[model samples]
Target: MDYSQLRFVVEIVETGSISKAASNLFISQPNLSNQIANLEKILGKNIFYRSNRGVTLTSYGVEVYSYAKALVEQYAMVEKKLMTRSNENKIKIASFGSEVINSQFFEICKRYNENNYEFNLCECGVEAAIQKVNMRDCDVALIIYSDFQQNKLGQLLTAQELELKNLFQGQLKIHVSQKYPLSKKSNITRKDLEGLFHVKKAYLFEGMFSLDYELQFLGIPENQKTILANGNKTYNDALHNLPSFAIEIDWKCNKALPSDLNRIPYENKNLPITCGLVKRKNEFLKEELSFFVEKLIDAYG
Candidate 1:
C-alpha cells in the first residue's frame, strides 16, 4: 500500500527471491516475509508461488507487480524532484573510467568549488554508471569502452534512451610495476602476456561481465589466472605490488602514473578506446553539467 511495500514487491519480483530481495533492501528475511504475508492476506490472494528454486508471480501477482513497479517509479520521481528543489545547486556526477579519478579531474572540480555548488561524485563500473544515467539517478556519467564495443554500446545507450557525447580517444596500454621484467619494453604483444596474471576492475553488478573489453580482446580464456580489484586505487596497487598487469587507456595512465609504475603500449590491433559522457536523451544540459563536460574535454581530449 505504501511506497516501502511497493518497493519490496518490485525488488522481490525483480530478484525472484524474497531472501535475495531482503538482502538487497537491507531488511531481515523474516520481516520481509511477514510484510508480504500481511499484504497477501489483505488482498485475499497469493501474489507469488513459493518454490525451492525461487518465487514466481501468480496470474494475479503479475497485475499487482505491474502497478507496484509504476508506483515505485513515480515515488522515485517525486523524491528526486523534492530533493532537487531543496538542493537546487547540487550536481551529481558519476564516472566509471580511471580518467575521472586523476589529479586533473580533481583540479577541474576544485574550480567549481568557488561557485558554492554542491557536488556528489561517484566511481562505479560501466554498466552501473549507465544505469544511473538511465534512471536519472545522476545528472551525468563518464564511461569508457573499447573501439570494438562502440556500435554495441551505442545501441545499448539508444535502448536506454540515453545520449553519449564523445570526450577523448586513446590507445590501450599495459600498466605494470617498474620492477616487472616486461616494463623495459616499449610495447608488448598478446603472446607476451600468455602466462601472466591480469588485474581487472570489479563490477558491483554480479553476472554483468560484458564491459571487460581488454580481457575479451586479448582472448584470455576463463581458465587464466585473474585478480579482481574493486576500484582504481586497488587496481593500481595490484599493478604495483603484485605480479600482475592491467590494461588502461593511455591518457588516464599518463595522467595518474605512479613513480614505480610503467605503462607500455599494447602492440596489437583494436587497442583503441573511447571515453564519453552519457546523459538522458533530449534532456537539456544544465550550465553546471555543460561546464564540467567542457573541463573534461579540455583536460583529456
Candidate 2:
C-alpha cells in the first residue's frame, strides 16, 4: 500500500472513528472509506470491522495497524526532512519512568532545544520501551528490571541486536507522607504496611503484568487496599491526603516530589533493580546522547 493509504489506516486507528479521522486528515468520509476498501482489496484482508458505534481492528488488522503506525511515523519524518531541506537531528527517548528521570535529564533536552533540535519522549512500560528501540523509532531507552528479569530480557534484547548498559542499581522503596504513621521507620517490612491504603503506578494494555506480580515484587499481600495512579503527582497526593503508601525505585533526592514525603527502604526478599540504558548494538553515540549520559551520571550522583 502507498504511504498515504497507510497514513489513512494510522489516522483511523488513532481517532477510533472514520468520520473523525476524515476531519483530522482533511478528507471526506466516503473517500476515506474508499481508501480503506482499496487497501483491503490489495491485501485481501479486512483492516477493520465497521459498525454504528465505531470501527475496531480485526484480529489481522491489529497486526497491520502496528506496522502501519511505525511506517507512517518514518514516512512523515522523511517527508519533513525533504520539505524543510535541512536534516535536523531529533532525539527520540522511550523510558519506563521516574527511576531515570531527574533534573539532569531535562537539562539535556533544554540544551538541545536551544539549537532547535526536536525530541520525542514516551513514558511507557518495559515492553513498549523495548519495542520502540527494536522498531528504530527511538534512539535510546531507559529501563529498570530486577536481575532475575535480565536472564530472559537480556537474551531477547541481544537477539534483537540491542545493547543494555547498566548505569547503577536502584533500591526499590515505599514512599509515604510525613504524616503517615509508619513514616518515621527507616526500613519498612510488609507488616508495617499491612492493611494500609496503597497508591501505585500501573501500566496497562502494553503488556501489563498482573496486579499479583506487582504486589509480589513489592512484598505486599493481595488483600492490601490498593488504588491506581498513573504518575508521581497523584501518588504523592494520595500519600499526602490519605493513610497510604507508594512504591518506586528510590530516587529520594528528587526535588520534583514533595519534601514532606518519607522514603523508606522496603525490606523483603531481595529484588535488585538495575537501572540502565538501551541502544542499538554498535551504534556510535551522538554528542547529545553523550551529554545525556554525562548528565544522567550527575543526576544519579
Candidate 3:
C-alpha cells in the first residue's frame, strides 16, 4: 500500500536478512519486522523462508517480489518523468558484466546525460541482472552470452519479456596455460583432451553447458574430465590447479587475456559470441531507454 513497505520487502530480498535490511535502511529491526508482518497479512503469503544461513524466497514470495519490484520501478519512473519536466531528472540503470561494471557503459550514459541528467548504476551477474529488468526493477539490462545452452538463452529472453538486438559477433577459443604439455604442440586434437581437469565458473551455469559440447567434440570420456565449479572468483585462480580450457570470443577475449595465458585460437572457427541490450516488451520502453540502447551498440560497433 505504501512505498516504504514495498522498499522494505525489496531490501529484505537484497540483503537477505531483516537485521541487515534494517541497518541499511536506517530503521529499527522491530519496526521492519512489523512492517513485513503487516505486508504479509495484506498479501496472505509468506515472502521469505527463514533459515540460519539467511532467507530464501518461497514460490509465493518470488511472485510477490516480482510484482512488488515492478510497482517500485514504475513509481521511480513517475518520479523521473516529473523531475525531467522540471529539468532535475536522473536515469537509473543496471548491467551484468565486468566490462560494464568497470565503466565501459559510461560512454553511452555520458552521451545521454547531455541534458545534465544524473545516472544511478548497478552491476550484477548475467542472470540476476536480467531478472531485475524483467521485474521492471531497472530501465535496461545488458548481458553477454559467453557460454550457450540449448534453448536456455532463448528461454531467458522470452520468459523475461526481453529482446536481444545483436551488436556484434566475436570469436570463442580454447585457451591453455604455457606450462601445460599442450603448450608445446602448435594445436591440440580432439583426442588430446582426455583425463583433463576443467576449471569452470561455479556461478555461471552456462560455463558447464559450453564445456559439455567441447568435451563431446574432443572425444574425451565424460568421467575422466573433472569439471570444478568455482564461486565469484575468476578462472585465473583455478588455472594452476587444473588443466582447464575456457571458451572466449574475439571481441571480449582480446581485452580479457592475461599475459601469462596462451590463447589457442579456435581459428576461423564458429565460436562467435553475440552481445546485446535486452529490454522488456515494446509497451514498457520509453524514448530515453531506446536512445540509451542505440548508443550502447553504436559506441561498441
Compare the candidates by lDDT and give the number of the best one: 2
State in Å the error of residue 216, model 1: 4.4
> In model 2, which regions exceed 4 Å deviation?
1-87, 204-218, 251-258, 268-270
Q: Which ten residues in a row have the lowest lDDT in candidate 1?
A: 204-213
Name every residue pair that clashes in candidate 2.
none
**Ranking 2 against 3 by TM-score, winner:** 2
Candidate 3 Cα RMSD (Å) = 10.7
Which lDDT tens digits does candidate 2 get at residues 32-116? 9999999999999999998889999999999999999899889888888689854377888888666446455677777877555
What digit string (tens of lDDT, one per residue) describes model 1 on residues 47-71? 9899889889999999999999999
RMSD of each: 9.5, 8.3, 10.7
| lDDT tens digits, residue span 121-220, model 3 | 6655567667777887777766666444526877878976787666655555555767777756656555555566655554333432344564354343
Model 3 ranges off by over 4 Å: 1-103, 106-127, 144-156, 178-186, 206-233, 240-242, 252-259, 266-269, 283-301
lDDT of 2: 0.77
Weakest ten-residue segment in model 3 by summed lDDT: 248-257
User: lDDT of all the models against the reference?
Assistant: 0.75, 0.77, 0.64
